[model samples]
Every structure is written in C-alpha cells, then in structure tokens.
Target: MTVAVTGIGVACGLGHGKTAFRKGLYEAPDIFSCLTREGRGPAEGEPPFIGVEMPEPSEVLAPRLARTASFSGRVALSVLQEAWQDGGLDDIDPERIGLVVGGSNLMSREQALAARDYSARLAYVPPRHAHMFLDTDICGLCASTFKIRGFAYSLGAASASGAVALIQAREAIRSGRVDVCIALGALQDLSAYDLHAMRSLGAMGSMRFSEQPGQACRPMDAARDGFIYGEACAALVLCRQDLAAAGKTYGRIAGVGLAVDGARGPEPNSAGQVRAAMTALVEAGLSASDIDYVNGHATGTPAGDDAECETYRTLGLEEARINATKSILGHGLSAAGAIETAAVFIQMKEGLLHPTRNLEKPLDSRFNWVRSEPAVHDIRRALKLSFGFGGMDAALVLEAPDSGGHTS
Candidate 1:
C-alpha cells in the first residue's frame, strides 16, 4: 500500500502557492499585519493582529457566488482548484474523486450576522445565511462546484483537523475506496471574531510584538507567549502510487496515527503525543531512528511547547533535528498541519530545514532543535506532528519518493 502526495496548495502568513511558500521558508516569518477583520478591527495604537493575505474571491469567482459563500467556502474553493490543476485531477475520473474539508470556522462574522438580529417584529435572517449556518455548506459547495460527486464531509479537531483529514483520505485510498482524494482545510479566516474569542478565552498571544512582528511567534523559545491565530487554506491531492506513477510526487504519506490526550482544557499531555508518534512509526514499518527529522507541533505557547519538548525527549527523538515552523508561519488552527506538511515538502525537496527563530533560551537543551537559521541537511524520512485542543494528536510519516520502499 503506497500513497503519494502529488500536488500541494497553501496560503498562509508565510506565502501562497507552493513556489512562494517554499521561497519564504528560506527567510524570516512574515506575520506583518492582520487585515482580515472586516469592520471590527484592532483598536488604534494596539499591536496589530498579523495574518496571511489571500487573494480576493471576487476577482476569480462571480460576484453573486462570492458574496453568498462563507469565508471557508471561498478559501476551500480557491485552494482546491489550484491543487486540482496542480495534480492534473481534471483529466482523471470525476466519480473517483473524494472531497474532504477540515475547519473550525467558529465565531465568524458571517455566522454572527445570520444568528443575530433579534428585532421586535421578527427575526430577519437572510437566505444566504444558510451556508454559514452549517459546516456541510463548505463541503457541499466544493462538491457541487467541482462536479466531484463522491463522498463529501467536513470535521474539526482543533488544530489537527487538516492532518486528520489527510489521514482519513489515506485510509480511504488504501482501503480500495476512492482512487483520488482531495483533502482541504481552512480556519479562522481574516476576522477579529476568532482573535477576540481566543483573547476572551485567554488562549491567544498577549506579548506585544508590535516592534518586531517577525519574532512574535516564538515557538520553542524561552520568551514564548502564545499562538497567534492566522488565516490559512491548503489542499493536498492524494492517490495511490500506482495511480500517480507518472505524476510528480512531493513525498509519500507512508504512515499515520492519531490519539486523544484526554485533556479537558488547555493542558498538555505527552502520552498522547508519544502514542501517536509510535503508532505512525509502526505503520510505516520504521523506528525512531529511521526518521531523519521532525516537524514539531510546537505552537509557541509556554505549556504546549514545554509539553512537546517533553514528548520528544520521552520518545527518544530528542537528538533528531526538529523544526518548529510556527516560528515562520503563525498558527493556522485546523489548517496548521496541512500548511506545515507543505513546508516539509519544500524542505525535503531542497535538502534543508528552516530554523526556529526567537529562541534566546532553549526549552530543552537535549532536543536537537534547528535554531535561528537554515541548515543544510538530507531528509530521506520525516515525521510531522500536530496536537490540538481537547488532546487531539495526529502524526504522519513521509518518505522521499526515491526511498527504496516506494516505487513512485
């Protein structure tokens, strides 16, 4: 059972498109300024909420369709279309394609408008609000628009949603289900709703990085504050190596594992993380030492970063060079894992890994953390880790396409 990642589409604080995102990886993070908060914006003089810029849907989609779609709808459509073309999916069987979108588009302005307006006469809810009212809307829209009449659904498990979606797609393809599956993820579109909501919940960063925006997301750094919510939408086209033999493959999704940390709140659990990692190793028919590097789940929060460091030490992978990409790209919530996987593809292709900046003091000296600058390295095998709220942990192992085990 072999799977290949034939195409990638990403839009994050780092950049958009595979080429730009790959180039941005060689430089500092670009958490410039958050411009997605329509109407309700940051107060004057406050440290601006940095965000990734996405092309306006109005320029590509018709005005009527663009206006009525939810923010996730716009992002999912844009990225999926890019991935579809990138993977040469249009030339393949339409019925063989499956659609899976992952996101927790909660507290969005569009949804707020739909559920509000308690007037004296009656509740005036626009018909267009129906789309925002349901998560199925995004999945359904992708299916209808693309004429991809296969299985379609949406789900969220905090930040690991994207990886979970990919894992599910891998299983389906391996189980003799769909021939090709397009898994896409989007989270907290350029809006202040999630920022304020995370602030109220005491989960977002409070450190004033106004003077140095690039250093704001200090993952695995001593001065780490919290994770910044960033807008992102990414899609990956997955198919069996046999089906995509002639196509370009970034890497192969060799193994996958998922677990629950069983934490009811904002707490860290190393057991779940280690379990997921071990399961992935077992599935890949590899061991701890088989991995050349790790793409850590470090999201800059003090507790999360500390817990991940402990997990790495427990798994005996402390010496394996680990890269924390949130230092370069702000957290994309559900889209984090997918976007980070894209980062891994670029790093693998280029034979180097980006360093974690802003680490004046290391959280754990034992862990071989890629610090402060790029490092020349040959990555034949890599593992990506993503842990989210409610103790959800997802892990994936990828091997170079030229690995002896894969024929693609």
Candidate 2:
C-alpha cells in the first residue's frame, strides 16, 4: 500500500503556511532571535534565549475552545486546519480519517506557568489545567475541531516523535485502518526548567554567538556548540496513493524505518543510523546510489553531527547533496522531524535546495554540502533522517510525485 503526501501545513519562525515558509527557506533564511517574551524569556543573569520563535498563527478558533486551549493546542489547530483544507479532506467521510500527534509533555511551559501563577492561590487555578497538562489534550482538541472520528492518539519518542508519528500514520493507512491520516508534529513548549536542564546537560548551545543570534545554530560547522531550540509545528496529510487527489500530491512516502540503539542516553550511534537508512532504502526497493539528497538530522551538536556524517559515509551516500534544516530553523525538538520533512517536500517540488545557514566551515570536506547559498537541483528521491534521545532513530524515503513511483 503506497501512501502519498497530499498537503502540508507549517508554523515556524520562518513564517506561517506554505508561501511564507517557502520564501523564508529560499529567499530570506535568517530569522533567529532572542526569546524575549514573558514566561518564555530567560531569568535574570541567565543567558539569553537565542532561537527561532514562530509567529502567532492566523487561524482563530471558537471562543469556547480558545479559552481553554494551550499554546500547543492553538498552533496545532492552525496547522491541522490548513492541512485538512489543503488536502480537500472535507469531501471524505470523517470516519475514515485519523489523527496522530507527535511529542510528549508538549505543554511544559504552560503547566509551569500555571503552577507558578496558582501557587499563591490554588483555589483560583483554572479547572482546564486538569486536561491541558496531558499531551493527549492536543489530540482531542484537534480531533474535535476537525471531527476526526477514525482514531487519534499521541506518540512520544523525544526528538524523533514527529517522524515516528508519521511512520505510524503511514502504517495505519497501509493496514486499511484508515483511508487518510494527519500526522502532526506538535510544538514542544519548553519551560525555563527544560532549557536550564538541557544547557546544564551540555546538549544545548552555549552563548558563543549570543550577540549574533542568527549564527548560534550552525549544523555541520566546525564551530558548532550544540543544538539550539526553535518553536515550530507542522502537519502533513497522507492518503492511500490511489485515493490521493490529482495535482494535489506533493510526494510519495516510499519507505520508512525506525530503529533503536541498544544503549540508552543522548549519544547517537552510527550503526543504528545505518540500519535505519538501509532498511528504508531496501523497503523502497532502492539502492544507495538512487538517493539524490539527504535532509540530515544535524542538530549542530558535535557528536551527533559526526555520527551522522559517518553514517552517510557508511551508506555510500557522500555524493548525495546534503544540508541540515536545523541550521536554518534551529532544532524544534519533537517538531524537528516533521518540519524538516515538509522542507524536503518543498525543495523537491521547487527543484531547489535551501542553504545551510552559518555553515562557514564544513566538518567533513569529502561530502557534497550545500553551504552558504541555495542551490538549484532536481531531486527525484530524498532521504530524511532523525534521531532522538533514548537511542531512537528514524528514516524515511520520499519520491517526487512525478517520479513514476507507486503514487504515480
């Protein structure tokens, strides 16, 4: 059972919707800024929060739902609505459509703020906190707003949550469980505690380029410190290939792979990455040489980037034009995978690859790296890789809509 991506919706620092995102990617790519908003900003004496923050979504929900919906819920509804309408899903039976939201503890910032505000007077705390704290709340909010009756749930795999959700949704469609599915990468609303913890753990970037926020996230660069945080949420509508609307399909989900490293921790394993990539290739009935581009999971972390480079070398994919979407958008945590996947589909359709921002010096000179500036290329097939804490790794093979693949 082949699956086709019929529509995509994105909300990120780059912008909202497809047009704005496309312009931000290829035209004006520099958008990182300091997080200066209340509650989200850094505390006194703390280092500035340097990363991309998404613009407020334009979609306005019903007053009743809006009153209780958290930040993640609002953003998820905005993106999902775009995807649903773009995919022309209204014509399909609501019972045949399912929803899968990615990420866990999505409302950490909301919960933290609520706890702080209500600590002085617990009696005044909003009753909505009971449901808003759970990650599944976003699922319910979106399902109800869109009336998705087939089945809906949330999946959490750290940073790989988005890709994992996408894989699960594909399987649901393949198994004849649903005719269409919406895989959404919910925005991970990190609280100050989460930021402090990551910085303390040495996984988040330091203040080396604090004055120049745009240069803080430099994936695959020798001066890279660690992954920077970004706020983003993206949604993709996938349907059975045969049922995909004509002229609406962006690409085909040819194959998908998910694997876990035996050991636990934040360290990435090249061997596990190799297994995932190889599995995806084999399932796609493709060899290494067939891949024209790779949307690498280069989070700007020193060890993570090196491991991915080695994985590419082992897979004989050095010739594939590769770039790190994180360099431009920063790391969206659980939202990274879906956001980057949307980038791949956009580049494939546009026949152009966006540049890796701030990649002044390449870590590995042997590989083909799109550095500094966007490049014009016709990508027929591409591979997207994502790795998370707890040794989770995921890979997906996407074919252009006109590639004469199963979707065609």
- Most accurate candidate by TM-score: 2
Report lDDT per candidate.
Answer: 0.77, 0.90
Indicate the TM-score of model 1. 0.92
Report the lDDT tens digits of candidate 1 across residue range 1-408.
Answer: 798999888776555577767777787656556555563466576555654455543223587777777766777777777788888887777888887777665436665444445444345666666565477788777887786766888878888988898998888788877889888876555345556666656667774775666667788888878886666778999988887847388889988999997897768788999999999988888988888899988888888888888888887886578888777777878888888887888898899998777877888888788888899988888999998888899999988888765332
Candidate 1 structure lDDT: 0.77
Off by over 4 Å in 1: 34-36, 39-59, 113-124, 190-193, 406-408
Report lDDT (Cα) of residue 322, candidate 2. Answer: 96
TM-score of each: 0.92, 0.98
- Write candidate 2's Cα lDDT for 209-258 as tens digits: 88898889999999999999999999999999889877889999998999
Clashing pairs in 2: none
